[model samples]
Target: MLDPELVERITARRAELDELEEQLAEQLAEVRAERDELAVAERVLERIARQLAE
Candidate 1:
């Protein structure tokens, strides 16, 4: 059987990892949203450039 203290330490580490994962997921979502917004802006600029070129 695993030592009780070892098991407790493992559980604590797992919780810490879970919290980090949650934080990273939130950050990733924000980055993706910003990327999408930039993509839209890029498209608008491209459209304007095409018209200006004509």
Candidate 2:
């Protein structure tokens, strides 16, 4: 069994870990949005190229 002080420290550290996880999730969401925008831009460029070729 752990001591009381150690248990308290672990509890506090867990909260910090949770906060960090939330921050990471937000950043991942932003990255995914940017990736989707890039994909749309790529499709537009391809269409323009096909028009020029004809």
Which 10-residue window in model 1 sums to the lowest lDDT?
1-10
lDDT of 1 by residue, 1-54 (tens): 889999999999999999999999999999999999999999999999999999
Predictions in order: lDDT: 0.99, 0.99
Residue pairs of candidate 1 with colliding backbone atoms:
none
lDDT of 2 at 20: 100
Off by over 4 Å in 2: none
Clashes of 2: 0
- Native-to-model Cα distance after best TM-score fit, residue 48 in candidate 2, in Å: 0.9
Q: How well does candidate 2 score on lDDT at residue 5?
A: 100
* Regions more than 4 Å wrong, model 1: none
